[model samples]
Target: MATPQIHIVKVQKIYRTANREVHALQDIDLEIYAGEFVTFLGPSGCGKSTLLNAIGGFSLPTSGTLTVDGKAVTKPGPDRGMVFQEYALFPWMTVAQNIEFGMEIQDKPKDFIKTKAEELLTKLQLKDFRDRFPKELSGGMRQRVAIARVLALDPPIMLMDEPFGALDALTRRTLQDELIRIWSEFKKTICFVTHGIEESIYLSDRVVVMTYRPGTVKAIVPIDLPRPRHTTSPEFNELKNILGTMVMEEQSRHQKAELAGTTAD
Candidate 1:
């Protein structure tokens, strides 16, 4: 078999506050092959975001290691593109300018940046909004700009943290389809983090379920359902139910642990 594009080996994360330290992640061993779409799904406070951050090099693990494309990740760079829950766009820049900002920072030639920005705008179906400010656009449009900005860099990997979490149901669904289309067309290795079980199942080749905080991998379920998945289909519901049960079980286990700690204290 070919080597996985992203390899995370026995990773752990610990956060230190004023008086104590908390373990946020434990022994997270994951491998994402090139062109695969994977998602981390769990309830609030799970380490889904942490794991995503670690992979993007926005944060470092306290122990173990993380590698992407055969190199260890120590800090953030243009090689991995990130899309956050918030749009994360510069308010002052127009859509086209924002998309070209990365290339500007890298001092890429003006013509190259312009061409790349236009290409990404076209690819993301945002060509008409190139002159608009982020504030002038709707939430979904702004997110499309955000995604285009990242794609303009031509990164090999994408780390998205609830990229659609803030949109309305209609907009979220629309963006989900757009995302899948983009993923299929580009074949970028993607690790998307979301709390929605159905959303995870719809977008991922495999779903990695995490335990509630002080999180660890509880289960990694392969979603073998046929593509162009339907939300109302019987097979889809069955897979959702199975994953839902596992998530609920993990949540219950975490709640019981919390209650026990309270009692002991």
Candidate 2:
């Protein structure tokens, strides 16, 4: 329906080296609708991040196609903004300057950039830290600035690669709530990659479970729970159990593969 905002068909990514070839992703066909929040969930080496990177145009697939709004995704564009596990802020710049960096590069007008930066500072709860540098702020505040920098461009799709994974649990939860608020207000399609089962359940409209290396879509589980989901709720735990089982199966496969590779070596 509505010509899915991001349409991926048979996407596969392979990394070739002098000694070996690694198939990072395989047969990844997914259709993400506009304004929907989706998470790619699986174990390490499952290619979830690889898939996200392909969608973000940080890397290209070896075969198949990924398109946004019916056009091929050959490179990164302003339509998509990416946040990483590492707070990728300019260490030398103040919070406000970091937020304004992208717009400045785009040659946005001085007044517009200033106004937008101020709005983001207030909206992301970073008003007091506006003049602080990255090192001066806490992990959570740094991420907020990173997010603000992305939002300054006002991308329609947000690609977040475990943006909260490095923070403390309490901080992670706080950022999750903030992200949900932002998504609700902006109505942006979000493609997030994470290893946290509960985090995926809490954030996504659908959880895409992936297989181990040479990743394939094992199952796409729709999260039907209402918003502001509670982790302890019976419904939440039930879905968590299902997803946890699927992820465990893949992780076992990954471990077996690793052992076999070691033995062969």
Candidate 3:
């Protein structure tokens, strides 16, 4: 069997404030197989983003270990590419320039950077917008540029944190299809975080349900539906219902916890 692309073992994250400590993650243990797509599905503040950050080496866990491709992750590197909820494109740069930013920072050869940037622009269907600025493009088009920027690095693993959360329904759906197509064609390992149950089920090979804050894994639900899944299909709806129920239960439990805390205070 192929090695796992990303691995987490009993990871925990804690934050220190002036008056108190915050537990963002607790005992997160996950394994993302190489070339497979996985998603962390949970409500807001569930530490899904925290876990992704840990794997990307942008944040360190208070305890436990994170490994990618059998190497310990201690800092951010080009091997793992990240796309945030907002398009972090440079407004001053053209689309092609934004995509080449990483390469430039790494002092990569100009020929290689140009070739890779052009290739990604073509692959992501953004060749026509290569010279356009973020302000000149639609939200979906800007997101495509954001994704292509990360893809230009050719990371073995891609970490996406609600990259489509800002778009409208129709635009989000279009980007979803585009993402799946890119994933299928590139076969890169992806760990996507989202609050959308249907989106998780549609995009992931396995949907990992997480608990409320101080989060831990609630369940890892495997999606057996075939590619190009139709949301209206019975099988798809069934899976959706299952995931929706899990999320609802977690949310309810979290509300109860919050109420108890309030009453005690």
Candidate 4:
């Protein structure tokens, strides 16, 4: 068997202010295989994003460890790429430049950077808009550029935090298909965070459900359905209902906490 591409063992994260401490994550244990796509599914304030942050090295856990390719992840590095819900493109730069930014920072040859940017622009269906700025593009177009920027870097793992959550339903579905196509071609190990149940089932090889505050893995459901999944189909609906039930249970806990003046996750 291939080695685990991303490993999380007993990971825990705590945030302490001057007074109170928030337990955001607990005992996260997962081994993501190379090229696999996994989604962290939970309601708002759950530790799904926290777990993604840990893997991206954006934040550290108070205990346990997260490793990629046998080495500990201590900081954000080239091996992992991140795509956020917000389009984090540089407003001053054109689409081409934004896509090439990471490569330029790495000091890769100028020709290689330019060539890669062109390839990604074409692949992401943004070749015509290469000269456009973020402000000039629509939400979906901007998001495509955001994803293209990360893709141009060619990281072995992609960490996405609700990258399509803000888009319209049609755009969201379109981008979901686009992302799956990209995943099939590039085969990057993906860890995506989302609260959408159908999105998780449609996109992931496994859905790791997270519980309320002081979140832990509540369940890990394997999505054994075939790709290009039809939401209207019986098999698809069945998977959705099963996963939705698990997710709603945790959401119910979150709602009860709100009534109790407790953690609202």
Candidate 5:
């Protein structure tokens, strides 16, 4: 087998303060191959985003290591691009300028930056909105810009933390389809964090289900369904139920904790 593109080993993360230590993650060891789509699925506080942040070099693990292309992930680097839940775009910059910002930061030649921006705008189907500011665009359009901005640098790995959670179902699925198309074309190793089981089932090659707090991998469910999957098909619904049970277990755990806290109060 080919060596893994992203290697995480024995990863543990603990958040310490003057009063308490919050154990966020433990015993996480995963190898994500090049050009694979993997989704981390779990409930709130399950460390799904925490793990993705660690891989993006935005969060430091209290123990163990995260590496990309044989390099230790100490801080945010271009090799791993991140798309957050929010668009994270500059309010003042136009779409073209926003897309070209990274290239400009790298001091690429003016012509190169312009060409790259045009190419991305065309690819994302935002060519007409090149001069428009983010506020002028709709939610879906803005997200397309956000994704185009990330792809500007051509990172081998894309870390997305619920990038579609805010949009309505129709738009969310539309973006999912757009993302699938983009991933198919570029084949970037994408690690996405989501709570929706069906969304996870639709987008991922494998769904890594996480448990409740101090989270660790509870299960890794492989998805063999074809592209443009029928959400109502027997095969797809069967996998959804299987994944749903695992997720509901954690959710039930959370509810019990909530009820216990209420009783204590």
Candidate 6:
């Protein structure tokens, strides 16, 4: 087998407040390979985002190690690009400008940035909106631009934190198809976090289901379904039911914890 591109070992993260410590992640050990698509799925507060952040080097693990291509991830770097649900684009910049922003920051040659920006604009079907600003576009268009901006950097690994969670169902499914196309064409290693069971099963080579608070891997379910999956198919529904049960259990645990905390207070 090929060596893993990302190796995480016994990773843990703790967030402290004045009165208490919140353990966000605990003993997470996994390996992700190059050009693979993996989804982190679980209930709210399960540290799915935390784990994705750790891999992107947005946050440090309190214990254990995270490495990409044999190098420890210490901080955010060009090797990994992150896409958030909020569509973190500059409102002041045009679609073209937003796509070129990263390359411009790196002082990439103007010609190269222009060429790359144009390439992504066309690839993402944003050529028509290149002159528009973020506020002028619809939510779906804004997200497409956000994705184009990230692709401009050509990072080998993309970290997405529920990037489609806020969109309408139709738009979400459309973007999911777009993402799959990009992944297949670009050969990127993507780590995605989402609360949608169908989304997880539809997009991932494997779905990593996390437990509730103090989150750790509850199960790593490989999605063996073929591409262009039908959500209503028997096999798809079977997998969805299984994942739904796992996530529902964790959510129940989270609800119980909340009640206990409230009682104690």
Per-residue lDDT tens digits of candidate 3, residues 1-265?
Answer: 6667788999999887767777779999888898899999998767899899998899988999889988999998888899889888899999999999998988999999989998999888899988988999988899999999888888888999999999999999999999999898888999999999999998999999999877899999999989899999999999989999999988887788777772111
lDDT of 6 by residue, 91-173 (tens): 99999999999998989999999899989999999999999999999888999998998899999999999999889999999
**Candidate 1: where are CA atoms >4 Å away?**
253-265
Off by over 4 Å in 2: 262-265
Q: What's the lDDT for residue 146 in model 3?
A: 90
Q: Write the per-residue lDDT of candidate 1 for residues 9-55, one digit (tens) a residue.
A: 99999988767777789999988999999999997667899999999
List the global CA lDDT of all models. Answer: 0.89, 0.93, 0.90, 0.91, 0.90, 0.93
Least accurate stretch of 10 residues (summed lDDT) in model 5? 256-265
* Cα TM-score of candidate 2: 0.97
The candidate 6 region of ten consecutive residues with least summed lDDT is 256-265
| Cα lDDT, model 6, residue 119 | 94
lDDT of 5: 0.90
Every model's Cα RMSD, please?
Answer: 2.4, 1.7, 2.2, 1.2, 2.0, 1.7
- Which candidate model has the greater TM-score, 1 or 6? 6
The lDDT of model 3 is 0.90
Q: What's each prediction's TM-score?
A: 0.94, 0.97, 0.94, 0.97, 0.96, 0.97
> 2 or 3, which is superior by lDDT?
2
Total clashing pairs for each candidate:
0, 0, 0, 0, 0, 0
Query: Which scores greater on TM-score, model 2 or model 5?
Result: 2
Please rank every candidate by lDDT, starting with the best.
6, 2, 4, 5, 3, 1
Off by over 4 Å in 6: 262-265
Ten contiguous residues with the weakest lDDT in model 3: 256-265
